[model samples]
Target: MRHNKWWLLVLALVLGLVLTACSGASDSTEDDNAGENESAEEKVLRISSPSDIPTMDPILAEDNVSIQYTDTVYEGLYRLAPEGEIVSGIAKKDETEVSEDGLTYTFHLREDAKWENGDPVTAQDFVYGWQRAINPDNKSFYANYLMSGKIKNAAEIYAGDLEPSELGVSAPDDYTFVVELEKPVPYFESYAAFPTFLPMNKEFIEEQGDDFALKPENMLSNGPFKMTEWNAEAGWKLEKNETYWDAENVALDGINVKVIKEPDTALSNYEVGELDRVTLYGSQVNDNQTSPEYNSLAETSVFWMKFNQESKTASKYMQNENFRKALAKAFNKQAYIDVVYGNDSTPVNYFVPKGFVKHPETEEDFQQGSDVLAYDVEAAQELWATAKQELGFEEVTLTFLSGDSDVAKSISEFMKGELESNLEGLTIEPNNVPWSQQLEIMRNKEYELAVSGWGPDYKDAISFVDLWVTGGENNDIAYSNKEYDALVNAAKGELATKPVERFEAMQEAEKIALEDAAIAPIMQRKTSVLAKDYVKGMDSLNPFGNDYSFKYVDIVK
Candidate 1:
C-alpha cells in the first residue's frame, strides 16, 4: 500500500510540472505571433505627382518637380508642416537662436541625427551645402534666391568675383553653424525650411562627384525616408530610413512616387486601385465634384501672363506699359476662369492671390480680383491706340508661348481671340511648346508674352513682391519700378522686427505692383486631388505645395 501511495504522489508531481511548462510555452508562442502580425501589417504607400522629377541633387534642382523629389530625400534645420508652421527637424528645439539684428542665424544640431552611411550629421554639412550652392561651377538658379545676398560673397561669387569658400556660412565645430544675411528678412526662418537649404554629406558628395545623385546608393539622406529606387523618367521609390532620428514617428514602410502627366491616365489608375492619389484638372473636376471620393483643395498659386520685357525681339512691343495694360484690360477674366476652372475656380485681378495675405493695419484682406482692373472694351481700345501711336507701328504681331497641355492650348486660344477681336491693329499668335521648353524660353527671356504661374516660396507678402524687385531672376517681365524696389527694400530693412509694419509695407508694394501692371493676374489656382478613402493625412496649406508626411499618414483597413 505504501509503494502504491508513493507512485501516485510522484505521478501527480510530474503532471503538475508538465502543465506548468505547457502554459509558459503557449504564452511565448502567442507573443511571437503578435509581433509577427504587427510586422506583416506594415504598409507601403504609393503617391503620384503631375510632373517628372528633374534631378535629385538639391544644388542642381530648381523646378517644382525637383523640389518635390528632394523633399523625400533631404531635411533642413526645420520643416514646414501641413499647416504651414515651422517645426524642428535635424535640430532639437533648444538649439536654434536668432540674432538681435535679425540678420544672422545660429543652429545647433542634435547628437543623434546622422547620415544613412553611419556618419554623424554636423554643422559642416550645412556649410558645405551653402558653399556648393553658391559655387560658380554649380550655377544653381535657386542659390541666389535662398542665399539672398546672405552668404558673405555669394552674390560676388555668382557674378564670378570670388571663391565659394568666401561665402558667409561658417562652422566652428561639428554641431555649431552660423549664417549671416545681407539684410534682415522677416521670413528667413520659413526659408530655412526649403529643401535647397538642407544639409548634405560633404564626404559622400565629393566622393561620388558628378555621378552622386544618379542612383539610390550614391546618395545619403537624413530624412524619414531614403531613396531606394530611381528610374529616371518612369518613377521612384522611397523606403523608411531605419537610421532616421525620428524613425519611430514614421509609420509607413515605404512610398512609391509615379510621374503621370496625363490627368485622365492618372485618374484611371486611381480608380483601378493602382494609384493612391491624383490631381484633377478642368472638366475632370466636374465629373468628380459630387463624388464622395473626391476632395478639392485651393492652393495659393497665381496663374498670370508673364511678359518678356528683356527680349530684344519680343520686347519691342511688350516693353511698352500701354501694350501690356491693353492686353490685361482686353482679356475677359470671368470667361477665362469659367472656361479653365469650370465651376471649381476663382478669377484673380490682383497679383497677390486671395487667402494669401491680409492687411496688418486695418485688418483688411488682400485677395485676387478684390480690387478690380475692369474688363472694359473702351478702356482696352484707348490703351491699344496709345501704344500703337507711341510705337509708330501699323500692326503689332505678338506670339504668346504656352505649354502643350490641353488646358494650356485652350488658354492660348482664348487670349488670341480676345486680343484680335478687341484691338483692330493687333495680331496675336499662339506658340504652344512643351512645358519644359516653355520654362527654358521664359528663363532666357525669348518670348513676347507667356502664360506662367508663381507658387509661393514662403508665407509672406514679400514672396510675391520680391519677384519684380528690379534684378530678381524671377522677374522675367523685366518690369522695373524704383518705387516698387524702394518699398520692398524698406519692408526688408525697417520692418524686420515689426510684423505689423512689415505687412503694411508689403501690401503697399503689392498694390503698387498691380496698379503698374507688372503682370496680368489671371486666376487663383484650386488644385484637385482624388485620393483613396483609405489614405488619410494628405493635406497642405496655401504656401507649401503637395507634400506627403508618411509619419502622419495611415492606410485604414
Candidate 2:
C-alpha cells in the first residue's frame, strides 16, 4: 500500500510538471507581443475578499478581513511563514536572548528593516504598539490577548490599577526590545507573530491623529507590501515595499483584492482572467472538481451558533438550559454541510477544531471521544417539551442574526429550516445584515442567535476556549460559569508550567461549555479555491492568522 501511494505521488508530480510546461508554452506568443507594454508581464496576484476590510489599525482589528490586511502592511518582532512556522520580521534571526528563568525575552531589531517613509524600524515601535493596544482609552478588542500571554502588569493596566507605561515592554535602546512576562509562555513567539502585536510608528500614528489607519495614505508599512490605494466601496491595492529589508526576495510586484461577496460573480471574473484565485461553494465545488485549477484546504476555523443570554426578546428562553440544549441538538450539521457547502468540511462537536492541537504527552488528537454536539431529533423534541413546561410557554420566536453574504444566508436558511422542523412551535426569523453591522449587533448583544466563527490567533487551544469566559471580549453570548472560569484560569495560571495539566484543564473547560450548550458547534470549514495554473508557491495553507502570505507567492512564467 505504501509503495502504491508513493507511486501515485510521483505520477502527480510528473503530471504537474507537464501541465506547467504546457501553460508556459501557450503563453509564449502573448509574452513576446507584450514585451513593449512591460506591465503585461508584471507579477501581480489578483484575489477576492468576501467583505471589506473593517480597519487597518492592528490594535482595533477583530474580523478576519481587517486582520489579514493588517498582517500584510505591518511587521512585528516575528512573522508567520507558510503553514504557521515562525520567521524573522524586524527581529534579527537567531539573535533573541532569553533569561534562564523564561520570564524575559530580548529581541534585537534589524537596522535595515524600515518603514515605507524611510523611518528605521526600531524596538520602540514595538514598545509603543504593545502599550497602545492594551491602553484603556484604545478599547482594543484584543486587549485580553496580552493578559492571556501573562505579560507583566497587562491585567493590572487593563483593570485600571496600573498605567499603560508600566505594561512590561520597554526599549532599552534603539534596536533592543525587552518583554517581561508574569509567567513563561511556550507560545510567546507565536503570539508575537499575531497582527495585534504588530508594531506601529508612534510618530506617524500621532501625526495622523483621528485619521490614523482609516485610509491607505494614513498607514505605514515595514512589511513586504505597502498599501497604495484603498476605497471601501471598491477594493484595495498593495505594492511591494522597496524599503523592506528583505525586498530582494519578495516575489510579487503587487496584490489586488476585490470586494466580492458572491461566488458566482467572483467565478465570472476569474474565468475572464481578471482575478487569479476564487473560492467555490455548494454546487460550484462539484462543478469545478475535475478542473486542474481546483484546490481545497481543511481549515482550522470553526463555525457555531451563539445564543445571547441577555437577549431582550428571548432572554427567558435562552436562559433555560433545556431550551439551549434542545436547539443545539435539533440541527443536523452533517446534512446541512452536505447541502450548503458540498465540500470536504466536517461537522464538529467541539469548540477546538480537530487536527489543531494534541495531547502534549500522548501525542493524541484533542478532539477524541466528544459528542456534546450530537444531533438527536427525538431527544431534542423531548428536551423542548421539558423546556416549554418549565417556561410555561407554547410558542416562541427568536431573531437569528447573520451576515448578508450569499454563503451566510445559505447557512442561516438551512439552520432555520432544521431547527423549525425539529423543535415544535419554534420560529426562527433570520435578520441578514452587512458583515460590519452583524459584528456590531453581536458585540452589543442585540441578537437572539447569531452565526459566527473563529480562526486561531495562535496555535494554542486557549485561543478558542478562552472566548467563553465571563466578560471575555469575544463573549457576546453572555454565558458564564464559575467552574468553567476556574478551569480556564487554572490552565493559564498554575498549569502554565505543566504542559499535560494545562491541556487537560482546557479540555475539561471545553467539555463543560459544550455540555451547557454555551454555543452550538456546527462545522469545521474547508476552503476550496480555484487558481490559475501559472500561480505557484502557495501550496502550504496557514492554519491560523491570515490564510495566505503573498510575500513568497509568484507568477510562474
Candidate 3:
C-alpha cells in the first residue's frame, strides 16, 4: 500500500514540475517555529515520506500520494470514518433520504459546509464534480470504472455517446441534491466517500481552468485541512481549514509532511522530535517492533506480479494459463515476506486482503479458502517444464517493473533470484523506475511481466476483481477473463440486492482470478511507521476512501 498511501495503487505525481510555484500564506494564525513557548496544542504533526505529492485534483489522482492530499482537502456527501464506515460530511446524515425503490436519493447539504474560500458548499458543487468526472472529454480513468452503470446515464456519458448534461445527478436548489441510480449499488454510500465523488466549486474551477487544483494558490479545501504549503521536494504542509464546517473537531493545528527520501534521515528526525512520525524499513524495523513509537499498520493492498498478455517479450508464454500458474507457484511467499515485510506482513494468495471484509451470511472470512496453494518447488518445476515445451521456447527473458525504493529494489532482486533459479530458461530482468514512471510504463503496456499492486477503491471486492476485467481502468496488465467479468458485473447489478448472492459472486470471481493466476499475489502490505505516542485517531487500515483520514487526528502532547 503506498499509504505509498496504499495505492501500490496510487499505485505516486506532482501538479507542476516544481513545487515552489504555489507559495503563499498558511491558514494557521500562529507561526509553527515561533519559539519553544509554543503550546502542545500549537504543535504541528510533522511526518516524513520518501516521495513527492502528485496531483491535488481527484479526477486525475491514481496514486496514493495524490489521493491522500485530496482526502485532506475535499468533502463529499459522506466522509470515511476510522473503521471504513461512511459518516456524514457535507451532507446531513439524519436528513439524507434514500427512497424505498433504492433508485432515488435526496441529500440535504449541511448549510455550514463551506470551502476554504468562505463560500458555502452547495449541492451544485457535487453535481459539477460528478459531471466533470463522467464527461468523456475529461478522459478519466476511474469514472466509468468506479461509477458507470450505477448512476443513471453515467455509463452512456462515459462512453461518449451521451452528453454529460444528461447524467442523472441534479441540484434543484443550492442545498438540495437528488441522485438517480440506474441500479441500486449496495456500497453506494462508500462510493460517495471516494475522492471521485468529492464536490468542487463550479465558479472556482471554471475561473481557474486547467490550473484549478494544480497548486496551493489555485486550490480550495472544504475538509479538515487546507494545503498551506506544497513544495514537492522541499515537502508540504496542511493547516487546519478555519472555514471547514467540522474544524472544531480537527485537533491538529497543522500537519507538516517532510519529503525525507532517505529512511535513515527520517528516523533521525523522528528521534530528535523534529518529526512526529517516520516510516521504518530494513533492520530499523526489526529493532523497533516492541517500541511504543513503532506503529504497525496492516493494509487492504495486495502487491502482485501482473502478467501482460499484450507484451512482446513473453506474451506467448503469458498467454498459457499453465505458464502463469507456473510463475505463481514458483515463488515462495514466506521467503518474500521475510525479505520485504521483515516478518511483519502476511502472505496473500488471493487478491482481497484479510480483514478487508467478512462473508455477509456466515460471518466467516471471504478469503478463508480462496487461495490455490502450489508452494511445492516440484510442482512448479513440473508445470514450468510443460509450459516451456508447449510454447517451444528454449529460453525466455521477461522484464520486471518496480518502484525505485530500497525495499522495492530488494524485493525485485529476491523475486528475480527465486524465479530464475526455480524455472528453467527463465530470465527475469528488473526495471526499477520512479513510482509515477512505473505507472506510465505499465499503462503503456511496455513490459512482459510487471510488479503491480492494487488497493481497493471501495469496500466492495469489485474494486480489485474488476481490475482484471477487460478494459478495466487498472487492468494495465491487459489480462482478460469474460466469466470473471460476468461474476463481477452480476455482483454489481442483478445480485446487488441479495447480499449473500453478491458475496458469493465476488468470491467466485476471486477464485477464478486466482486459480487462473491472472496476477501472482505476493503479500498483503502492512506499513511500519514510527508514530509518536501523541499521535492518535488513525486506524491501521481503512477499507474505504484514503488509507488515513486526518479529520480527527491530533497530537495529544
Candidate 3 colliding pairs: 1-6, 2-5, 2-6, 3-6, 7-10, 8-11, 10-63, 10-64, 13-54, 14-54
Instruction: Measure candidate 2: CA RMSD.
Output: 8.0
Per-candidate Cα lDDT values, in order, are 0.66, 0.75, 0.72
- List residue ranges in candidate 1 displaced over 4 A: 1-42, 360-362, 367-372, 545-551
Relative to the true structure, candidate 3 reaches a TM of 0.92
Local accuracy of candidate 2 as per-residue lDDT tens digits, 1-557: 00000000000010010000000000111111222433866887777766666578877766666666677788888887887788988897599998998899999988888989999988888999999989878987565544534899997787778899998999999999999999888668767777778788999999999999888889989999999888774677888999989999988888877776676877877787677777777788889999999888766667778899999889999999999999999999888777677788888888777898999999998887678668989989999999999999999998888777677788779888999999999999989887667767877899998867776767777777777889876778999999999999888778888999999999999999999999988877676778888888666556666656668789886
What local lDDT score does residue 152 receive in model 1, on the 0 to 100 scale? 62
Candidates 1 and 3: which is better by TM-score? 3
RMSD of each: 17.2, 8.0, 4.7
lDDT of 3 by residue, 272-374 (tens): 6676676666677898888977777766666677889888766788889889988888999888867665647677788766777788878887787654744
Clash count (model 3, backbone only): 10
Candidate 1 lDDT by residue in tens digits, 1-557: 00000000000010010000000000001111222344447666665544445468876555555555565578878775665567887765466888887767888888798889888888899988888888878867667655656556778988889888888889988888888877777767766776667898888998998898889888898888898877754677777888888888877777777655455766776676666676666577788888887776665555677777887776777778888788888888878766655556577777655776677666677653444355777898999899989989878788888766556677788898987999987887899875556656776788888766655666566667777889775676788989989888887776667878777777788878777777887765565667768776665432542233345666775
